[model samples]
Target chain A: MSFINYASREINLKIVYYGPGLCGKTTNLQYIYQRTAPEAKGKMISLATETERTLFFDFLPLSLGEIKGFKTRFHLYTVPGQVFYDASRKLILKGVDGVVFVADSQADRLDANVESLENLRDNLEEYGYQLEKLPYVIQYNKRDLPNVTPVEELSRLLNPGKVPEFSACAPKGEGVFDTLKAVAKLMLISLKKNEK
Target chain B: MLGSQSSLVLFDEEFSNITSILEKLLVEANAKALFLVDKDGQLISSTGETDQMDTTSLASLTAGNIAATGGLAKLLGEKEFSVLFHEGEKDNLHLSLVASRVILVVIFDQRSSLGLVRLRVRKWNEELEKIFNSLEKKAKEKGAGNQSFFAEITDEDIDNLFR
Candidate 1:
């Protein structure tokens, strides 16, 4: 959820990146953290297992810029994509303003993508949020891999609602900013719509 | 709009009110620092000894800790875990849930005792709850009306930020 603090002249928005295990949700956050200017980004925190799998979630805070006299800060989080971490994922989605479903584009992970998307919808529904109505986007990650599905096929399967979808290789930062900017733009537009 | 939207809109008046309460709590509790963080990990307000600290990271981690503990509680057939504490070599942390929407975190050292911090927190929790209740009502009314700041914000204003 977006928090507009008029006292501090700042607006805070929460955005969560979610996908199946090893779908590169954490990689997407690390790419953003590595590229963001030191002054613009806060320390990134990862609650992960000993083997580096996300045990809980990952957090990154980015200060974009000022908008209408209020500093705009985006708090980016990534839920643990492992299926057993359903409870943790639901906690992370409690107050989300936007979501980016980072689908692993590998042909073999199609079922994983579908299952994770369903889990995302169910978790959001528990919080009274409709995935169809929220400011959401999709990223087809691992696109540089050989076994990846075509963008068209991925879209046909994952982007049924036709939210802004991007092709990304998160580790190398390909299409990272584009995906971020698109969802951030949609969130800002949604804010304006909410005021109406 | 505020009634349905999960977003939190803090106007100047309520913000000051919350800040003052925090400041008072810090002095009364004799703590090193205190922070008010929402359940979603957003830092709402904080005071004392925070300049040298990374409050953003602290707030996010604190919320994560609370969520994890709350999950543990549900498995044990409890509704929620309202308080959490961490003792360290040099400092201690006292965390409590306020209004079921935000977390109140107090950090203290050898100079303060847990008894004092708990006493002050218990007394101020009610006042904080009242202010937040009023804040919700005010935000709902203003959001339903037309005085919203976003009302004056054109798409250009929003686009300009990214540029």
Candidate 2:
């Protein structure tokens, strides 16, 4: 949910990064956290298990400068990508303003990507949010790997809505900001339309 | 998710009232700080000595903790846990649900006992509930008017953000 506090002159939006396990969701967040200026970001918190897999989520609060006198803040969160963590994933999607589907582009993970996308749809439906109506984007991540699927094939399979999609190698930070910017822009535009 | 999209629209008047109520809770509970967070982890209002604490991360973690507890409660045939407490060597945290949508988190130190914090929180909960109930009602009644405030914002206003 996008909380617009006119009293505080602040506009806060929640964006979630969701994908299958080891799909570079955490890597995307780490890269953004590292690149963001000190004044523009807050402490990144990750609740992970002993093996460093995201157990609950990873949270990063960012300031995207100001828009029309309102301080625009984006709270970025990444869900535990492991399939058994469906309960945790549903909880994190409660008040999401937008979602960045970080689809693993490795040729072998096609089925996992499709399953995760279906899961996203089911979860959003539970919250009364339609993927078609919500601000959504897709990132075909792990593009640097040799066993990657072609962008065209990935788009045909995962980008059914044809939302703003990006090719990213998150560990190297490629397309990280591009993906963020695209989703953030879509979210703001959606917020504006909702006001009417 | 609540019935409608759970976005908090805080006007100055309501915000002031909420802060005053929070201030009263801080004094009555003898706590170091108090934070009002949405169930979805947005920090709505904060009071007291929070200079050293990172309330943003705290809010998100606290919400996640509460959500996990709520899930456990369901498995045990309960509606919700409603309250959670974490006691540390020096600082302790008391978290309670308010109006089913917002959470009240109190961080206190050795100076305050659990009994006092609980007592104060019990008394204040009713008052906070009443306040939020009315706020929700007002939001629904004047939702169109409230939304009008944002109607003036243009695409350029949002697009220029990247620049």
Interface RMSD score of each model: 3.2, 1.6
Q: Comparing to the true complex, what docking class would candidate 1 get?
A: medium
lDDT of 1 by residue, A26-125 (tens): 9999999999999999999999999999999999999998877889999999999999989999899878999999999999999999999999999988
For B1-163, candidate 1 gives per-residue lDDT tens digits of 1124557778888888889999999999999999999888999999999999999999999999998898899899998889899999999999999888789999999999999999999999999999888887887788776346676777888778777
Instruction: At residue B29, give the lDDT of candidate 2.
Output: 92
List candidate 2 stretches off by more than 4 Å.
none
Give candidate 2's TM-score. Answer: 0.97
Tens digits of per-residue lDDT for model 2 on B35-56? 9998889888999999998989
Best by TM-score: 2
User: Candidate 1 at residue A124, lDDT?
Assistant: 89
lDDT of 2 by residue, A1-196 (tens): 7777767999999999999999999999999999999999999999999999999899999998887788999999999999999999988888999999999999999999999999999999998999989999999999999998999999999987889999999999999999999999999888878877
DockQ (Cα-based) per candidate? 0.62, 0.71
